[model samples]
Target: MVGERKQEKDVKREKVRGAQDKGRKTERKGQKSKRTECADFTDKPRIFPAEVIAGKPVDISCTFDTTCNGTAPVLTWDTPTDVSGSISNTVTQHGVTLTYTSVLTLTASLKHHGQTLTCRVRYPSVSSERTLILTVQYAPQDLSMTSLDMINASLINIIEGNSTVIICSVKSFPASNLTWRHLNVPMNRTSSNNELWLVIPHVTSRDTGDYECVAENEHGAVEGSITITVEHAPRNLSMTSLDMINASWINIIEGNSTVIICSVESFPVSNLTWRHLNVTMNRTRSNNELWLVIPHVTSRDTGDYECVAENEHGAVEGSITITVELIICCVESFPASNLTWRHLNVSMNRTCSSNELWLVIPHVTSRDTGDYVCVAENEHGAVEGSITIIVEHTPQNLSMTSIDMINASWINIIEGNPTVIICSVKSFPVSNLMWQHLNVPMNRTSSNNELWLVIPHVTSRDTGDYECVAENEHGAVEGSITITVEHAPRNLSMTFLDMINSSSVNIIEGNSAVIICSVASFPASNLTWRHLNVTMNRTSSNNELWLVIPHVTSSDTGDYECAAENDHGAVEWSITITVECRDSSEWTAGLLTAGIMLNLFVAGILTFVYVRKSKTATEERVAEISDIELSPSPLTVKHQGKQNMLLTDPRNTTREGETSAPQGSL
Candidate 1:
């Protein structure tokens, strides 16, 4: 308002000066013919308002007082933004004194600040001008917020212990005072020029939130905000204990509530959880702390309890143990006495503060199911109390065994014999043992830990793998062993000439005869052919024996026996070989051969004496017939079989086109 009044006073003074100069000039001119002279400013031309507000309208005027021969000076304006409007000119004549005034209504902007604004007054012979630098006043605008070192970081996100610099800048007439605010609350800061800077060094998780930048002046205040997020990994995990009890071991009474607390320090408010035996539990959390409550404790609820805190960075956890102990109290006697808790026969040696004794068992399995005894002894007498703890578990040490002398992999059973096989197992709460052969369940007689499978007479069909499956309420297990049935030779028979299987056979005199004996047995039973109850030949190959008699004479005809034997027993099957005797033809031919042999016999005696004398013929005759027992003593010789047989000395008598059966010892 003061600037507007000063501009009005300057305009009035210029008009008065113009009136004084024009009056003298007008008097001089009136005395002559009324002619106008070139106008000159009696008062200097002036432009009002050196400073202006941006984006607002203000009138700028330039007034000139001229020695008037009654002509007004023309005025024009030059401005920074190239603004053009009508410039009003007023010319006043007071007795030939004239004053010229020009006004331009202008709206300045920030671009016109510090630039030149000019108003020029012109006459035909004289010209004058007024120029001033424009100062623009405006509220803070075109506001921007950024980090000084980071690119496009209006909002900052960095790891913990890192640094970031934030800056707030704007355009204003009198440079704005920049301030920083957090969560809409202004923060005190040092004075700055044009721009506000917030230096956050060594940022922690507490530094994460909204931070706003405000740039203000007398005109107006403008603000911009940025978010700073500081990331810190989860760390410093702890499981706190409320009482003086150990953190890892907490013994609580039954039907009492047990609370476990876990705490951690982190950013972004870590998620907290509780777990028991790897299963999640209901938990409540507040800030960086987590808690879990377990009510009505029992032996089933005894296990490890864990607390976990998790976030985007990482996760941390802590664990504690809780148990409900078995208490055995009271050692009352005539006087005060001490008591001891023992597991079976061994002393537990765990101390307690009072008379009550506690037995704590952790992670009980099948092996831990047994009786626990507590004995209290003093100088007078000894008393005892016992408690039994049973844990249910699966079968252990399951196996199948046989009473027979056998190896680990297999059990051998002979035919027509009784064998006992047993399946046993060890487990808690009594386990049922079952027997299976090739997946077929066997009806077995079960006693305590053993199940018996009795085979009254083992046969070839019983040779297979057997399974023993033990089961309880907890689980089941199975074991297996192979059983093989053994038998002696059976179904012995003889085939005559390899073409007949019978017990008896007939043959013609001077005809060839052949017989084969075969039997079936495990471990390959030995097969033998006998004649007249005398051992003939035996072969162990394929459990078969061959008897070859090339020429069937009456001496060769007898009962031929085929026998098969193994370690178990022996069996015999006989074939009667009947040879037909020759009739009168044999008698006539024998008489003719005897008459001819009589003539040669006398001559052969002389020739035989000559050959025999050279080699002791008397001794050679005795040796040749020594094996043929003429007395028929039938010398008994015990062999590898159960029967005794006749013996003959070994000799090889080979005849052309005839093959003899195996002779003994040759």
Candidate 2:
């Protein structure tokens, strides 16, 4: 029973706690549903419009709505986001669709680029956001600029003018406008002949300045500038004379600005300057004309003055002079004179002296007439003059009054014979005339009044002037006569009388010889000969002369001659002969000497042999004596008284057998 009561109490308490927990769980479920169902458009995908409404600012936005609850919801739209233009956007409530109205504004600025319109919508249970592009549809980055330069203009200076052109070009995408300005001031620009141009006719100093070209486009803008200068021709050139009192002057002159007034019918104008004497004057162009003002005047400046002009076509020059002095006085007509003519030997009155001024000429001839001047002078620079004096003349009359052929002229009896010429003439006084047969000189014949000439063998060497001079108290005169020589035939001869047979030789060595050549000539001739490459000596001799040879040799026999030459011609005669020597044994003199020597030797040997043999034979023989005995008895003495008997006088002739002879004592 106790267990039953505990279970019942626990049941009642648990029922009450379960009811409270169920209520709390239901409230938590409701709070979680509300939180999850709230609408947030940022979390969902939205579509933006392709093309924006042109010319206006339309802003795109996102808004939230929690009332709608379906797949496609109805919506409401409001104003745009961009403030540049009026907002005109419309939204339809068929699920979700939005469209913008157009307020077109074509005059848009660069800031309108990429502008867009916004369309915000409200739905019953859902929300959404979208944007539509609002583009001005303009050209971008359209502006550009370029430039060119002008250089090296030599023709501009030579042409004496100024011309120019601009080369800066401008390009833009939207066709920008270009304009030119000078020093920041707008310049006149025009379109003529389908091209933009800036023409400045008659350029002046004021035109030289900086220039600018401004280009503008819808996308951007650009500007550029250049410097320009204008030039003009030379001017104000003039010239003047330094010494006008001395008659010197020029029209135009200047140094710098003065233009050399030159005609420019062609392209280039000539340079201008001044010239005087042998030097050129330095000057420059100033205003209009070339100006030349010399500081001083001198004699050196008194030469030809010239103006020179030149161009590319050609050049020319003109000249004049500056005379420094003027003539003061001149005169004419003075003294009268008589004229006459005469013949002098050398020159026709080379000089006239005061003594020769007497005008008394002798033996009138035609050589002395010429124009003579006579001047007279006095105080004021003295002026007195006369005309020419004329002298008329004729040949003097002369003849041979007496002629002596033996004394002056003759004919030759033989060749080269001399002669004399003698002739006399009668004029105011007796005059002698000389003569010459031919051209050869004639020795002077006489002096003073009478002339004489002697000639010897007149030949071609004597063809010249033969003069006869006559003199007296009044004056002197000369008569000239030329003598031409006649051609005289000349003759000359050379003779070789005995040239060959005079040669001599020796038949033995070491002998003397001679060879003689006789050459004689009428007009004198020369003789020369050679032997063994040596010239043989020649001595002038008569016909029977001799040539001596000191020694002779075998080589002496060769071509030998004596060449004789004269005025006619020359001739050589020669002789060649060889000499043979005989043997020594064949000579009589050598044989006689040998024979005499042999005879003498043989006679000496024979005599010596005979004497020696005789001696030897005698040595070989023995001596023998005869034997006879005599017995002596007494000595017989015969005294002086014995004239008697002593036998028949022994002084007489003895008989064959004698009786007794005297005995001697033994």
Candidate 3:
């Protein structure tokens, strides 16, 4: 029994040892399982509000579920170099599980934005980490403007009709809202991240103003501004007068003041100037208006004036005409020699001069109207004064004078001949005179008081009542005269009565033979018959005239002339009358035949002479040719030597083989 007790004690001892070893192995396995478990925070491993604004205070907390080990867990935070914060930890237990919390307090800024913030939990076995990406929301800062086109300047300048854009740049945590404005009015814009563009298309002078670009976000708003200057040329330029009826022209008396204004309608105010005679004049400019003041105007100041406006774009000008009128002082005078007056360097008669130094004309005539100079002479020197005189009068005694001195109201002229008419008038002031035919105005060569009207070729159409009209400032007067154009007689002829077959009258001795004279004339011309250079009594009515002889006799056989005369002139026709005796009729026929035979005989003799002369010329030419061929060579040489000697010495001489011929020999 003692031995059995000892073995049992030993087995018990082995059993105790085995149980202790198993307990130690279970402890090691529990420690390994705890290490493998996830140590993430109970809350999400991220920041509370996924975003954070720069320069703003924020709270970041992380919680981790720890294993039941009875040991405290450490919490740590990792942050950027620009960020500083305090981290605190709190531990809680639930049954066998332990929870650890870490809290970080810091002010977030732009530097911390878009960075990761980490929170870590440290335990005996392993550590747990939580990461938070910082989304810092901040206002726009460092706002500036950048030009996108040709307008790359602080102050934007663009010509009319050009386009440009300016961008506003800024720095912000988030994309900020952008806007563009001009003169407090919203402008069209295009926006991008951190930049806004203000677009100006087809810029003009009307678009020139201050412009603003604004960038805004939930945090704050910032703006940038630029000045836009739209340049344009001068336009709608004009000149006007304050002292005249017409805007473009003015007439002012000498020594009077006048004002001329120049205006321009343009942007970026144009410079205005006044010019005269192509030279710049003194002027004052205010805004778009320029003023040229003439304090004391003179005759020399009368001319064309120009108003010019200029800008960077171009120049424009307008013109006005100024006329300076002469200031006249009136003077009256009566006939007297004490005062001497000269007009245009000519002395005035006593009838025009007066004792009064100032001239006072009673009846102002054109001759008295001029620039008159008065002279008062002394032994020392001569003093002179000048004045301009103007006279006014009415026309009087308008008259028409023709080339023929006829009645004032009636005249007679011939057709197809040049006719001249003078129209004259008498008036105190010279009048304008004109000539008219049948109440129609006629063209004339005119002088001061007379008008000469010439008709180169007068026709029947030119025959009418002519009028001379004189017109003046007061009234007009006219005188009329009737003109009758006469044509000479035409187609004048004389016929014999009682002779049907012949132009000559044949009747027995002491018997009666009648003759008739006819003609065509404008005015009935007085007709008469002249027998043997002596005029005979005749009767005439209208264009017809009759001349009668009671008895036919030898005296009537002589030449008879039918004559017609009037105011135009005279025309005549002649005819011969034959008084035949019945007993001597045969003798008359024989005498006529004998006269015809004598004429034929004379013609035959002239023809015979012409033929004989032609035949004689032909015979002479043949004889001359024959003589030349038959002449001897020695004789020819002798003749040639004799001719040469005669030419050399004027005296006639003979050669060795020749003899002298008679003076008439050929």
Give the winner by TM-score. Answer: 3
Off by over 4 Å in 1: 1-45, 55-57, 68-71, 78-88, 92-97, 106-133, 148-154, 181-192, 209-212, 236-251, 254-261, 268-297, 300-316, 325-666
Backbone clash numbers for all candidates listed: 5, 54, 10
lDDT of 2 by residue, 171-269 (tens): 333355567777667775432111234555545555656666666555455665555544333332222342232323322111101112222222233
Tens digits of per-residue lDDT for model 1 on 487-538?
8778786665323346667766665665667676665678888776788888
User: Which clashing pairs does model 3 show?
Assistant: 41-63, 41-64, 52-135, 52-136, 53-137, 55-108, 332-359, 332-360, 333-359, 333-360
Better of 2 and 3 by lDDT: 3
Across residues 240-319, which tens digit of lDDT does each residue of candidate 3 receive? 77455477877654565788888997766777888899898865443689888999888899899988887777878888
Best first by lDDT, ranked: 1, 3, 2
> What lDDT would each prediction earn against the true structure?
0.64, 0.37, 0.62
Ranking by TM-score: 3, 1, 2
Q: Model 3 misses residue 489 by how many Å? A: 99
Per-candidate TM equals 0.38, 0.22, 0.42
lDDT at 603, model 1: 58
